[model samples]
Target: MSVSSVDDRQRAARLLLRHPLIRSTDEERYRLVRRYSSDLEEWFEINTGWAMHADSEVVRLEREPATVADPTHPFATRRGGAVLSRRRYVLLMLGLSVLERSDSQVALGRLAEQVIAAGTAPEFAAAGFSFDLSTREERSDLVAAVQLLLEWGVLVRVAGDEQDFVHKTGDALYDVSRRVLSQLLVTRRGPSTISAQTLDDRMVAMRDRGAAPTTELRNLRLRHTLTRRLIDDPVLYFADLDDEESAYLRSQRAALCRRITEFTGLVAEIRREGIAMVDLDDDLSDVRMPEKGTEGHVTLLVAEFLARSGVAEHFVASLVAHVRSIAPDFAKYWRASALEADAAADLVATSLGRLSALRLITRTGDIVRVLPALARFALAEPTILGGRKP
Candidate 1:
């Protein structure tokens, strides 16, 4: 490829990585994606097993997580960025099911009624799920789901506002984009074909059943799985890989990392313990460290403390105390509540949450273990002129 071609391809891949679904409404990005559709499609498929589809209207990358059990990244509201709760997730799925059977346009009240019916089904009730939409809270949950759909281009407001419906003062209407709805699921097998009784079994069955029973196929699956983690995750730790995966990655690490760097423009930060596809632009990740604001300040401070303290593990209470001890110096720049002794726990929890999500640390109950990646945040001692220590 020409240098310009390489740059364009990298830009297109970064765009898709940041926003998996791009409609023509995003004019420039959509056009760029379409320009290199064939190359990008082949790259994603070969590297990550992710399917890419594009038409005149939209470009969609069907992505599946390397690890389904990861709970660090949740779907948050586009408006306030509140993480979707279990109730909201259930309502979201229920609303989508209703929309799947509805007309191109749907009304807020009608959607809520259908969702209520779906929630009250015997199977749902047996599963301990219930939502009648009789209360404003329930209605708000439905609105949250609708807002997410709207954000995703699955729904476009045509007539009314969602807040009015939440207040019971009026209703809203939306134009459902069936194309976007159909593109949302990224499973390897048709969900209907998976007859596994439990959700976990069903998930495993859906992913594994379609694979071929051959050595080449197995190796290909391993390569795709590892590449997906390298691209999507903050860090791909060697400790997390199985015996086969570890052996394969050990032999193929350089070629695998080179392919990723060439395609995505990410520099591979190779450590003794793992590999991190570091985005120089720092925009590819959903979570960021050394960020701004009071929360960010506390997180950076806690990270430095963890890295410099030389202790691998610390109790949650100890971290809370550390936060409280430092609050006096930073109190003026932080929120009023950040200085409260009791608020230290919340601060500690928030800081640890960000760190853990970034793979810098791990928390098990009250214990937090600082991982190897966090050492990057450690500060070296400053020296004065003529080699004099500060």
Candidate 2:
């Protein structure tokens, strides 16, 4: 490839990785992808086993969304965290349903009324969900879900503000980007069509039915799935892989890494326990480790503790204890009121959640196994008195 061609491919890769869904409103990035649409699509399909879709209204990359959640990711809003609480998640689904029924221009109050009616209906009430607009918490939650949609480009703000609704002061207006709304759900079946009652079952049933049934096709999908994981995650542990996946990945790992490197400029960092696509440029990932704050300090502390000799696994209770013991010294500097607790267990939970999300550690129930990547975080060598290399 020519120099410019290589740069364009990398730019396309970075754009899609940075913002997976590029709406028309994302003017600069959207235009960048538009100019390189063919190249981006070709690169994405050949390298990551995914598709890059582009049109006048939007540009999107189709890939399996990550299940991990971090409460402090920068892409998310100042108020919103990386992880959505269960209540907020339910509200999000409710908001989507409402959006589907809304016209091109959506009025905030109208949407709230419809959601309240549906949520308070006998069937929904029987299911244990209640929507009372009078309650500040309920209002805030629905607004949070709507704000999330706004951030995702599914709904564009044309008028009023969501903060008004949250404060019980006023309502907002929005324009529904139907093109973007349609692309929000990556599932094959609508929620109404699914027979599953629980979220997990429904999620499983929502997989694209177009997937071929043949064994050869299934094998192809397995390869695609594994490749996508490498491109998307910091690491892929063998313990997390299925038997067939492990076998396929073991045999075709080098080929997969080469294919990805050619397309996205990502280098493979392979180890015995897992494989990670190391983007030395740091342009691909949405989250980072060893951040700067109390959370970062706590993570470093935990990583150091785990990386130390004789430490194999960490328990939630033990981690909580550690955080509680040391929280006082850092509580004054902590930015989040949520983390400024007397015990700071929640802060510990958030840190561990982030660590797990980064793939530096694996969590099963209460126990966390520090992965190989974290070994590199060992405390820097002590500096000598003369500022000489130690």
Candidate 3:
């Protein structure tokens, strides 16, 4: 397709939502983006309230409160995942700090040396953090951090193995992707000047550094926040929008919906109550209904039951009972969570959580107020009509 084609815009929009679309990994996308980089940047910023970081080898969109965690995926496995513990997070940041001062092509030995040197400094002593390369476990943790960097496109392996470094057999060399490294610092200002004693305080100080947002800034924030919710979230209800947001949505819903559909190929199914962008692709979202396994069966069954029952609200106890009652039917194939002591409760929670995530049900405490979107999922059992015999 040509650079300025509708197809290009659609692909770009998908990539923007699914970033860090690295040039190293996806050179075709990278080059296409680079060709029409200016337009894509403007479109993303104007429509979604996200900043696009484009350069020679990468096009990354910075989404704040940078949520990268996937409950379904393990911590170490997520290429763009968030660090689990404060200790590991500190190491990640420290490693990044160490990489900042190094050459374009940095050696593993040099990087670790810098990290260890920085850790033992009098300043970072509060964390009581130290990395001893002599210890295998510590070395492995460091390697984990480096591996994460590789996934991030911040570092590309030149000619060495992290396992070698972990085993103390040999050092490794990595060609730092400078474009990726440049966008790594999330904040405009470093935390050196912040007079905050604790991490929370430091974060707050950093957040509050800029001038109070003007009306334009406030509007941008609102648009971006709401757009993110609509895209990432399963539902957007009119009742959920604030006074100002409600007003904005009312005025700009058409324009907003049109742009979203045009760019992302999602059809906006609007109603008096709320709006949802129906993904025809069906593969963009992590959670899927009519899925397999114990969780999937329970979700579909409970959803069907809830839709058929037409209850405005339900207790967890009721769902639990339903799950226990039906366990025997599916228990033969799905043995994992079928017969556990807390099977009923766990199944109920999982099913309800999935339903809630999909915007089919709203859970207030133990009560779930089934929403209108659920009417779509009401399935009719097959009827045995003997037409040929007749």
Give each prediction's root-mean-square deviation over alpha carbons: 2.1, 3.7, 4.7
Model 2: which ten-residue window has the lowest total lDDT? 66-75
Q: Give me the candidate number with maximum lDDT.
A: 1
Question: Would you list the clashing residue pairs of candidate 2?
Answer: 71-82
Error of 3 at 38 (Å): 2.3
Candidate closest to the true structure, highest TM-score: 1
**Residue-wise C-alpha lDDT for candidate 1, range 175-267, written one tens digit per residue:** 999888888888878788988899888888777737468988888888999999999889999999999999999999999999999999999
Q: Tell me the lDDT of model 1 at 390.
A: 62
Q: List per-prediction Cα lDDT, in the order shown.
A: 0.89, 0.75, 0.75
For candidate 1, report its TM-score. Answer: 0.95
Candidate 3 TM-score versus the reference: 0.75
List of clashing residue pairs for candidate 3 = none
TM-score of each: 0.95, 0.85, 0.75
Candidate with more favorable, higher lDDT: 1 or 2? 1
Q: Following a full C-alpha superposition, what root-mean-square deviation does model 3 have from the true structure?
A: 4.7
- Candidate 1, run of 10 with poorest lDDT: 72-81
Model 2, range 252-314, lDDT digits (tens) per residue? 988888888877788988878787888888767656676777777777777776776347787
